[model samples]
Target: MAILIYTQNYDGKFKKSVFELVTYGAAVAKELGTEVTAVTTGKLDTETLKELGKYGAEKIITITNEELNDFSAQAYAYAIEQVAKKINADLIIFGNNPYGRAIAPRLSVKLNAGLAAGVTALPSSVSPFTVKKRVFSGKAFADVVIKSETKIITLNQNSYKVEENPVDISTEEFTAEIPEGAYAVKPIETVKSSGKMSVTDAEILVSGGRGLKGPENWGMIEEMAEILGAGTSCSRPVSDLDWRPHEEHVGQTGKVVAPNLYIAIGISGAIQHLAGVNGSKVMVVINTDPEAPFFEAADYGIIGDAFEVVPKLNEAFKKFKAEN
Candidate 1:
C-alpha cells in the first residue's frame, strides 16, 4: 500500500491539518507496511521540509519554487498527480482547507479515486476503504464505502488532533513541469482575521448575534474576548450585513468551529447556525429567549439580556483576575 499527503505551505508554515493528515496517512502506511510520503509545492524555506517527520511522514516529496506563490489549481493538481504516479499511492489525504477544497476534486477526477470531504474520524477500514462524514449540514452522518482502486480523503480541520511529538522526517525535492494554462480566477485580495486567536486555534470562543443591537455595541464582545484571550465570531446575518467579514461568520455558509468552550451571546440557536458550531466540546448559550434551541446543545445556559449579563460577567472575570 502506497500513501501520499498533499499540504499547503502558508507563509512557510504548514496548515494545522497537515499534522492530522500526516498522522492518519502514516498509520495507514504502517498498517500496510508501506512508505508514507508527503507532497507539497510552494514558496517555503527548505528547513520546513524536515518538519514532516514529526507527523510520521517517512519522506516529503516537495517542489520548492517561487513561481508557485499564488494558487494555481492546475499547478497543484499536476504536481500531486506526479507524486501519486511516482509513489503509486493507494491513498492521498489533504487538510480540507480552502486550497485543498480547490485541489481535492480535481485530484479525485485525475486519480480516478473516491472523494469524501468534511471527514471527522479516520478510516474504520482501509481495504475497500470506508469513511464517515457529516451530512445534512451535521444534522446526521453517513458512512461511505469507496470500492474504487484508489482512495482520497480530506480531513476537516479541528476534527482530529495532531501528534504533539513526531520523529523528524527527511525530505526530497521532486520537480515537475507545470502545465501551461491561464487561470480562470486569481485572488487579488486576501483578508485575514484580526482576532487574538483564530476560531479554529482558539480554546475559547465568544460570539454574538442580532442581540448585539448594532456594530457600535460590538465593543463589549470584543473587550470580553480580549480579556479571555479568545476568538470572536458572529452570526451569519451579522456578517452578511457587513458588520463582520465573511470569514468571521460561523455558520453553514461560513467556517465551522469546534473549540474547547463556545460562548454564544444574544445568539439564537437556529438549526443552520448550530450546524457549524455543534462540534464544540463545551457550549455556553447566553440568550434572552429561554426557548432558544441552542440551549439543548449547551453545557450551560443563561437566559438574560446580553447587554446586562455580559457586563456583569466581565466585571466578575476582572475581579477574579485581580484577586488571583
Candidate 2:
C-alpha cells in the first residue's frame, strides 16, 4: 500500500540483499498498515523471481530493458523514478551496494525525496517516519525522519537475518516503456573479479595484510582459506601493491563485509579497515605483535607469528572437526 523495494538482480539471480531487503520492507509495511511491492530491474530468472513471494512482497513488478543490462546510473534512476511514480509508492528501499549507492541518490534528486544512506536498523515508528542508521563509521547512530511525501533508503548489508518462507507468491510484469534520456556517462570497460564469493558476500573470509611479510607468503593465506572453504581478502595496502585482487580488499574505500566468521592473519587493524569489518559476527585476529591494533577489536586474539601459528590453527581446526 505504501512501500516499494528496488531489487538488483545480479546476473539475473537475486542476491542475499534481495531476500533481506524484501523481508525488512515487508515488516515495515506490516507495521505501517501497508503492503510492500518489490520492483526488479533487468533480466531475471523466472524460478528465482517466484521465490521472492515468500519474503512477503505482496506483488512483484519487473522491468526488462536491455538499456539496463549494464548499470547505467542515469537509466536506472530514470526507470525507478518512473516505476515509483506509476505506483505512487511513498517509501522506497535499496541495498547499500555500489550500484545502490549510485542510483538511490539520483532517484532521490529526480523524485525530490529524502534519502538516508547506510541504514543499519529498521525504522522505528514514531508518528512521523524515522530510521536508525550508522554514523561516523559505526561509532555512532542517528535516527532520521523524512517528512517528504517520498522517502528513499539504502539498507546496510548483512544487518538483518534472512527470513525464509515457503508459500506461493504472485508476479506481475511491468511494461513501463523507457523514455529517451541524455546519455551523460559512457560505458567503460567492465573489469570483473575472477572469483565467485567476494569478502563481502563470503560466508567465511580469510584475510591478510602487511603481516604476511611479502606477497610470496600469500600462498599460505590462499591454502588455508581454500582448505576452510572461505574467501580471501586483505587490508587496503595489500590491494594497493596488487598482492590481492581489488575486489577482495576490505575496509573503507573498499568493500564492507559482515561474514559469519572473519579470520585476520598477520594484519594490523586500522580504524578505516575495522570500520568496514566491524559488522562481522565473529573475528579472530592472528598476529605476532601483541599490540597489533586488530586484537583490541577481535572476538579472539592470538599473539604469535602467523607463519607458525596459522598452520597449527588449521591442523587443530581439522582435527576437532574430524573428532566431533
Candidate 3:
C-alpha cells in the first residue's frame, strides 16, 4: 500500500500549500515504509506535473476529463476515491483548505476510512495511527487515534514546513466515469478576482479593524499592504459596517488564514477573530488599547494610535527595503 496525496491545483498550477502537502505526505510515507503518490485533476503539461517529484511524489496521476475541470466536491471526491482504490492507498493526505474540507469527509465515507481533519503534525505513532489536531477552535489540542484499516488526514496550513526530497517520478492519466448526479449542483458562472493577492495564498497580510475609523481611511491599510507586498484583510466589525468587503474579513465567521506574518492594525482581538488567525507564524498587533485581547496572542504588540504608528512603520519598511 502507498500514501496518496491530493495535490489540488488552481488553473493548472500548483501552490505552496500543495508542495507542503506533498512534503508532509512524503514524511508520512517514509514513516510507514511506503512510496507516496500525488493525484490531481485538470489538464497540465508534463513539466508542471513533474514538480510534485521534487517533494517525493514517486508517481503522479492526473484525471483529465474535460467535465472535471469545474470543481464539484462530490465529483472530485469520487475521482480521488477511484484513484485510492486503484493504488490501494492505505493513507490519504490533503491540505486542510477549502477543497480538502469539502472532499476529505466524503472520500472517507466512500472508502470506509477514518478521517482526521485539521491535523497539525505527522502521526506520533504509526502503529496505532495517532495524530494531533487543534481543538476548541484553536484553543487546545487533541490526539486522535484512527483504528480503521484505511486512514485519511487533512494537514492544517503552515503546520508543516515544505521539504524537498527528489525522486524519479512517473505520470499517468485516469478517466473517471462520473455519474450524472455528480453535476446536480453545477456552477453556471465563475467570476475571477484580479489585481489583488488572495488572502488565503498570501504569506504576509496587513489587516485593519474598526479602529481605522472608516472606509475612507482604508487607503493607509492598502498602502501598507502594497509596500509590503502583502494581502489586505479586516476584522468582522469592519466588514459588518461595510468599511471593507466581507471577503477580506478574517475571523471564525470569515475565511481562515495562516500566513507567515499577520499585521493587525487597529483591530481589537476577539476570540472569534483569534481563532482564525492564531495559526499565523508571527502575529503583530497594533492598537491604542493596551488591554486589547489581541496583544496577548501577538508575537509583537504596539500600544499606539494606528494613524501615527502605521505611517512611521510604512516609512521604516520603505527605508529597509530601499537599503537592502
Candidate 4:
C-alpha cells in the first residue's frame, strides 16, 4: 500500500501549497509506515518536478495527456483514480483548495472510498482512520472517522506546517486514457490576474469594506497593500457595489481565507464576513464606530475615522520598514 498526493500546479509551476501538501503527505506516510507518491498533470520539466522530493515524495508521476491542458474535474479525477489503482494507493491526499473541493468528492465516489474534506491534522489512529476538521464556518471542530479500506482526504490550507524531509526520488510519465466525453465542458479561454498576490495565497491582506466610502478612495487601500507587500481584498457589499471585483470579495458566499495577518478598514464585522476571515491568525480592525462588531473579533482595534487612521498607519509602516 502507498500514500498518494495530488499536487496541483499553476502555469507549469508549483506553489507553496503544493509543498505543504507534499510535506503533509510525507508525515502521513511515515505514520502509516508507507511511502508517498505524488501525482500531477501538465507540461512541467523534470527539475521543476524534482522539488517535490525535498518534502518527502519518493516518486513523482506526471500525466502528459494533451487534452488535460485545461482543468476538468471529471477528467482530472479519472486520471488520479487510474494512478491510485496502478500504484495500489490506500490513502490519497489533496490540498483543500478549489481543485480539491471539486475533484475529491467525485474521486471518492469513483473509488468507492470514504472521504474527509477540510482535514486539519493527521489521523489520530490508523486502525480506524480519524481526522479533525473545522465545521460551522470555522466556528467549531469535528473529528470524522473514515472506515473505508481506501480513503481520501483534503488537507486544509495553512493548517499543517511545511517541513523538509528529503529523500531520493524517481519520476515517471503516464498518459491517461481519457474517454471522448471527458472534455464535454472545456474552458474556452482563461484569464489570469497579472502582477498581484492572490488573496488565498497572501500571508498578509489589506481588505476594505463600505467604510472606504467609494472606489475612488481605494487608492489608499492599494497604497497600504503595496507598502506592506500584501494583497488587497474587499467585503461582499463593496464587491456587490462594483467598488472592487467579485474576485476580491471574502465572506460566507465569497472566498474563504486564513492569512497570517488581516487588516480590516471601515468594515463592520458581520457573522457572515467573520466566518470567512475568522481563520486569520491576527485581525486588526480600524473603524469610526466604537461599538463596531469587528472590534469584538479584532486582535487590535482603532476607534477613529479610517481616513485619518489609515494614512497615519501607512506612514508608520513605511517608517518601520525604513528603519529595520
lDDT of 3 at 226: 88
Better of 1 and 4 by lDDT: 4
Task: For residues 161-193, write the lDDT of model 3, one tens digit per residue.
Answer: 999999999999999888878977778997777
Residue-wise C-alpha lDDT for candidate 2, range 198-246, written one tens digit per residue: 7777778999988887888888788778777899989999999998778
Candidates 1 and 3 compared: the better one by TM-score is 3
lDDT of each: 0.81, 0.84, 0.91, 0.92
- Predicted candidate 1 versus true structure: per-residue lDDT over 1-324, tens digit per residue: 788888776677975667778877777777778878888876556567667777788788778655566788877787788889988888888876777788889989998888898788877877658788888878888898988888888887777777754765777787776656725568798776563466666768889898888889888888888778788998998998888767678888778888878899988989889998998889999999999999998899999999899999988878887788
Question: Which pairs clash in model 1?
Answer: 53-169
Q: Which stretches of candidate 3 lie over 4 Å from their true place?
A: none
**TM-score for candidate 4, residues paired by index:** 0.96
Candidate 2, residue 60: Cα displacement in angstroms equals 0.9
Stretches of candidate 2 off by over 4 Å are 43-45, 320-324
Residue-level error in angstroms, candidate 4, position 186: 2.7
Runs with alpha carbons beyond 4 Å of true place in candidate 1: 182-184, 187-201, 315-324
Per-candidate alpha-carbon RMSD to the true structure: 2.4, 1.9, 1.2, 1.3
Better of 2 and 4 by TM-score: 4
lDDT of 4 at 282: 98
